[model samples]
Target: MSLHDPAQLMDERRRLEGLGLSVTRYGGAIGLIGLVLACLMGFIQENGMDRFFFVYLTNFIFFLSISLGALCFTGIQHVTRAGWSIVVRRLMELLAANVVLMAILFIPIIFGLHSLYHWTHAEAVAHDPILQHKAPYLNTAFFLFRAVIFFAVWIGLALFFLRKSTEQDESGDYKISIRLEKVSSWGLFLYAMTTTYASFDWLMSLDPHWYSTIYGVYFFAGSAVALFATLSALCIGLQKSGRLTRAITTEHYHDLGKFLFAFTIFWAYIAFSQYMLYWYANKPETTGWILRRQTAPMLWVSLSLIFCHFFLPFFGLLSRHIKRNKSLLFFWAIWMLVMHWVDIYWLVMPEYVHQYGEIGAAPFGLMDIFCLIGFGGLYAAGFAMWARGRSLIPMKDPRLAESLTFENA
Candidate 1:
């Protein structure tokens, strides 16, 4: 029953039988098929491919940023020499490992470049002084180069930390811990830099003329909240399945809930800060984006994000009792996960609605839900595929004892 008891550890491993890897495989296949069908539907429609690209990039950035945040969280844990998270660190590691899969998913975006990015077209660049001025940085070649670099840095970091962690599992060398701590400092810096620029390239550049200096931070906040939501779900799901119930406890779930609660506030803060700046400035270019959201159909989506994404969760998770209750935390976690989609949908879909004027549902286009399912299913598949056979906890981490015995003060 103790942390050091091998029998206790082995018993947790016994609970992880199959762990639903087949489900992921089938789900991923279905998601991939749905994505293909969605693309075909778009290509056949009037402005179909463009709409498809919009949905693709929206969901891509959503899931990609989630993995990036997970990777960043793992690196932060390593860099800080954290003790309580050792039990959940393997889950972070596996989620981060999905960055490799995300890099591959980006390939289709490259093919649909013109449809998504207006800057890719020379004539538009010629007419628009801003696009012309930003041509050097926003050009197709340079953009592709930066995307490759971002993925390379991200994937490299994911692989390095994963290998080291798994290596520690086999070797149990304390030096490996020290080594991870040493590298994570620089790794996190690299993560921040790459992610900031990547956000500009991928999401912010969708409207080349519109810009926000805090855009990257806003994206990071949303991503971090979504990732924390995912972590809560995974941890709770595993516990429900009778896995990691020993190494992980209600105390750990409480901490995860606290994180979910905290980052929900953080997302609202960044969102407001960004909006506050643009609203206060009242510049036509900047204000137009906000104006569009506040206008008609999108105004509703924006308002929903407030109550759904911010205020509701804020009050729902404010209590210590709620944070500690698995059912309540899981409910909020699932809620946020859906709201996270709504967040990104609000960010992307409104533009298309304004231009094309009512594509799918109110704010979201017709294909938007399919895109979400496609990406969610695929992301789950990636996380599950990597998680299979790996320890439900970091079984060999020396500090894992500390994690298993963690108690909140």
Candidate 2:
């Protein structure tokens, strides 16, 4: 059968029964091992508990950002009614659904509240006027309430989209697509507000003395970069495993690479904008956050991000050939994913050092590795579980035809 034949596209390889089972088995095992070792390291090392919570939060946010990015793009494609993405939209839905798993993973951060947030200390709040001023929004009860609301919105949106998209697979109903487009319109608004406030509450409040109006956008930009990189990598991995080989063509990958490239610049733009504003203003509260990263070991990390995160990938992915070539695109995709982690590490690890009185010391260590592996393994397992018995592409999407034959102009 020809590769373009719709009748033969729904082959046995399009489903993930065997692949999903294997990924689930190994992914779950590795996750358990990583989590166990991370726990041991947390207790066995000095100030281990504190380090544990901070690193845990860092890894949690890193993975969470990927899902948030997936959710954002899923809504975006629907809102725009983009046809080029239908061939790969199922992967985005699968990734977005992992937000449920991320919610469960948030439990550790809740327990570490007192250790992670200086504002959580009653004594600190009493002494610091700034903390007192921010008290209403930063209090533990309100923080928890906001977290619940955030998760509720995310879970509801994720499940709704995933459920509806999957239903269309069985029902072959184009009206479901219309319903999704309608939901995505308002869903994006809720996503924007929740993501912004969540970033403020979870990350910005770590210091309690610093604030940035654009921090949420900064986070969103990096998440966008992560999302595109993830989708590209996953699609390549699936093709490599001999699944979705026909449905997801080079054209789909070309589009994914373009997104990855576009968002890499977007992330850099937002990052530099935030830094430039703070630098120009020279305000102590705002400058303090940037200063922490500019000093010592973190200073190197900061400089590296400018080059590694932006410049290197920016040039590497600039070629049209690179975007369509599976091997090259996969390399940049993995490269961007690593750089995205570094970006998150730079945002987070400085605070961990500043809090522990290890201002000059680099925070890199075995625990960071352990936490990353732990979270990563679980993330893979969740993705695999979601993929089980499901089509790797939206086999019946109204736009699938357009996507399958899509070509760049």
After superposition on all CA atoms, what RMSD does each candidate show versus the true structure? Answer: 1.8, 1.2
CA lDDT, candidate 2, residue 78: 99
lDDT of 1 by residue, 235-323 (tens): 88887787776777778888888888888999999999999998888989888889878976677889999899999999999998998
lDDT of 1: 0.84
| Each prediction's TM-score versus the true structure | 0.95, 0.98
Superposed Cα deviation of residue 224, candidate 2 (Å) = 0.8
> Model 2, 99-156: lDDT tens per residue?
9999999988999998899999999889999999999889999999999999999999
Off by over 4 Å in 2: none
Scored against the true structure, residue 200 in model 2 reaches a CA lDDT of 94
**lDDT (CA) per prediction:** 0.84, 0.90
Best by TM-score: 2
Clashes of each: 3, 0
